[model samples]
Target: MSLPLTAGETRLIVAAADAFFPPDGPIPRSGSEAGCVQWFERYLALSDRRQRLLIRLMLAFVQLAPLLLGPERRRFTRQSAPARIAFLARASKSRIYFLRVVFLSLRAMMTMAYLSDEIVANAIGMKADTDPFGLGGQPPLERMVPPPTPQASGVRLKGGGPAVEPGLGDVG
Candidate 1:
């Protein structure tokens, strides 16, 4: 297994999938599915080997899917969106093409996860409690985690000025 994802990454993916695919709902979800996570794990392993191949596989998958499904007006292939998803999932599970397919699938999942929350949050006009990009302060937790000490937190580290300009010294 690959190194565990950071809590923030997990939170982001979860939130996105929840927003994108409601429980007992029609739309497809990412990372929330048991297989999606497994797909990501497998892909991450492959990425550790050949990163560029990931991109190639994704492009190939998209271009080949429609043709492979044939122009039949069947239930699966009739609708383009879901069919593409199903096809990709199945391909990602293929042992022979597992590396390539997994890479594409994970990349797609991550992309979807990165966007879902923001899109829903915007559609409903709800402001995000935390930055979606995970660049800001931590989201709320059950209990407060203590802040690091000045020394450990890099408060006293010199050779540079404060990260932000100090406002007029409040010393009265």
Candidate 2:
């Protein structure tokens, strides 16, 4: 087996992995298949501040996702394989940001598989057809929905209009 991971490197990798896989979907293969664990390990060892900044940005991006998407977060978290793979294929700066946060989160290493998927998907142009937020041609079900409309009561009884006076209807 390869040498053990350092504490900081392990922390970063785990965090990146957790955000990659939600509760549902196919269980990804090991770190060797993705090669990101190695990438991460090598990356963490470096003293570059840019990586640190990218990681910070990624964490904020992920945390904001919950608020920005709202109810849709549940569905996005359980996305279809195609969508999941598409998101993973791309390894852009955005992916790095995601990876950094997940690493910090200290989630399971298994989750990293999904991140690898996204990086790979992105590189192969899968992201071109799919938007990270599922905005681009994605099915309506996965898209964010407008808040429910407030029901309008035609009887306009605001400001105590005596709609329910003391003996209005068969008081016992």
Candidate 3:
């Protein structure tokens, strides 16, 4: 499905994904080639309006960050691959929590997009054997037990004394 992002925004996402998950080793395609942009588009489409807006804002920041933070003031998409990678690496180490969060979030998305491909999984010897019936072993959710909820106790006052009930004290 078509995403809500503008053309420029879409280009930026593609470029960012490519930079974050460049094709290497046995991998034959970059994140964008593995359909990262399409995955991101679908994800945004499924998200709530607020979430979509926040994701868009994050992408915008990622796209513009190179111009603001890099030694050379250039757009992220226009930067060379090495420059892009360096910018992201620096952002990942930023002292600002928001910058680090944004870098981590983008890295996660890029990794997810790149590694989720069946070809990549098979190439990495991680492809699961297909089971037509419901015989792929029990799902992990079936083994989980809900934890018991803790009961609330009355508040304790200072000095290690039991909490006094209001109006229950001796009146002299």
Candidate 4:
């Protein structure tokens, strides 16, 4: 699949995934080893416009954050593995709520993509396709939607929305 972001964005996300999923514990596969980059690309494509924009902005901010916060002035992807790990560690413990939120959100996004992989999900003993509520088993009913408000009238009817399945909407 064609990646929409710049090369630097791609590398930075890969770097983040590496830091977030280092091979130090119960997890058997590294994020990259689990094909996190491809998963993230699919995640981005399926996101609504606003979600995609927010994720892209988070990636851009995190890519440059090492320069401002790290001991050395370097882009995130250019930093060594230890440096990348330290960067995320510091961001996670940052006193500033905004910094913590940014890094944590990025971490969640990457983790979601990583575990969606078939091998990883099975290794972790998770039934990735379990949708207990059955909400998405069928197409939404015509009468299920409430009357759209004046401001949000067009949002619900948009076609090609996010995947309707319960897991790994990575088919994109």
**What TM-score would you give candidate 4 relative to the actual structure?**
0.72
lDDT of each: 0.46, 0.46, 0.78, 0.80
> Among all windows of ten consecutive residues in candidate 3, which has the lowest summed lDDT?
149-158
State in Å the error of residue 50, model 1: 10
Residues 1-172 of candidate 1 have per-residue lDDT tens digits of 3454445444433433333353454433333652333444455555654553553344344444446444533333234455545544555565656445544664567654433445444644657555665545655662266666554332343567544224434354
Model 3 Cα lDDT, one tens digit per residue, 129-153: 5765555676768646556856335
TM-score of each: 0.29, 0.27, 0.71, 0.72
Best by TM-score: 4
For residues 69-132, write the lDDT of model 4, one tens digit per residue. Answer: 8786898898998999898889999998989999889988888878887888888798845667
Ordered from best to worst lDDT, the candidate numbers read: 4, 3, 1, 2
In the range 114-150, model 2's lDDT, one tens digit per residue, is: 4446655564454443366646685686565776866
Please give the TM-score that candidate 1 achieves against the real structure. 0.29
Q: What is the Cα-based lDDT of residue 102 in candidate 2?
A: 50
The reply for model 3, stretches above 4 Å from the true place, is: 1-3, 24-26, 128-172
Give the lowest summed-lDDT range of ten residues in model 4. Answer: 162-171
Residue 20, model 3: lDDT of 75
